[model samples]
Target: MAAAAGPATLPAVVEELLSEMAAAVRDGAPISDEHLLSLKFVFGSSAIQALDLADRQSITLISSPSGRCIYQVLGSSGKTYMCLASCHYCSCPAFAFSVLQTGDNLLCKHLLAVYLSQAMRTCQQLSVSDKQLTDMLLIERTQEA
Candidate 1:
């Protein structure tokens, strides 16, 4: 007799779905309504939450002179984390454990907040020089550690 199979992990499921969607797009195949709905269902909740955080002004972006994307996100615990938008990196446990470990390019709430803000052009980013950015990052890293 064949052995029973367990459920696919969340990351595996998401990765497969995305890969299929990308292939379909590349092949010029029309994505059905069901496919769109499935994608929406997978990301809807987190997207809404991220938008809410952005609306609440919890996400502040700092424009880097070197063109690196940086954001300061005020989390639910009133703690701030540095989010690197381009890299989908965050100075938070969720990024370290979930995203980095799983090799999933998933954004945490903080990174999502920054992403939405940038996409909407609503984030008033503070422009900083390279030296200033480096100094600020150094200070923040030291404080967090």
Candidate 2:
């Protein structure tokens, strides 16, 4: 008899879905509705909220000429959160509590928003100099301190 298989890991499932969206973008084709549905099915309410945030144009991609990129999301509470998609980091309380501290969720809604915005090509893009990017980061850190 064959052994039963367990459920797919969250990271693996997310990576696979994102890879499909990325491939669609690379091929100059629109992401299929099925793909978005899959995201909703996997991520649940967070996916819907993320889609709403992305549709509202609340996510910004700030990139420097040197190839560093960061995401800024205007949350529903009118607060801004910085997100690093590459590292799966979001400067949000929910991220700290739910994602990191409790480990109840794989990602916060803000990070999901960033990912959804990027995949849908809906994010507002800003290009800044490397020095400006550094200054922005410094200012943000100073404010947090």
Candidate 3:
């Protein structure tokens, strides 16, 4: 008998959907309702909150001339959390507890907001120098320390 393959992980599924959404955006095509439904079904409340955050224009994409990008998402609590989508990292407590510590969730709502805002082309973009970006990271780390 053939061995059974494991099901795709939630992170992998989310990545696939995000890729499709990005491609659609690149092609100037609207994201299909089915895709949105799939996202909502997969992510549940996180997805719903992310969609709301994106719609509210609470995400900012800060980019350096060298092409590195970071995201800042304003939480419902009115605090901004730094999100690095490439590394799947967020400075939110939910991310630390749920995603990193307990591993109960693959991502927090802030990361979802970043991904959704990015895919939907809804993020506010700001360009700065590489040094400035580095400084921002250093400041964030210092604050955490």
TM-score for predicted model 3 compared with the true structure: 0.81
**Per-residue alpha-carbon lDDT of model 3 for 1-145, expressed as tens digits?**
9977654344677889998998999999998998899987877788889889988999999999899989989998898889987778899889999889998777899988888888888999889899999998888888888
Residue-level error in angstroms, candidate 2, position 30: 6.8
In terms of lDDT, which candidate is strongest?
3
Number of the top TM-score candidate: 3
lDDT of each: 0.68, 0.87, 0.87
Q: Which ten residues in a row have the lowest lDDT in candidate 3?
A: 3-12
Instruction: Give the residue spans of candidate 3 off by over 4 A.
Output: 1-10, 24-30
Compared with the true structure, the alpha-carbon lDDT of candidate 1 equals 0.68
Query: What C-alpha lDDT, on a 0 to 100 scale, does residue 56 get in candidate 1?
Result: 81
Better of 1 and 3 by lDDT: 3
Off by over 4 Å in 1: 1-40, 102-105
Across residues 3-72, which tens digit of lDDT does each residue of candidate 1 receive? Answer: 7776423456555665665566557775456655664576656556665776788887787768865788
lDDT of 3: 0.87
lDDT of model 2 at position 91: 88
TM-scores vs. true structure, each candidate: 0.62, 0.80, 0.81
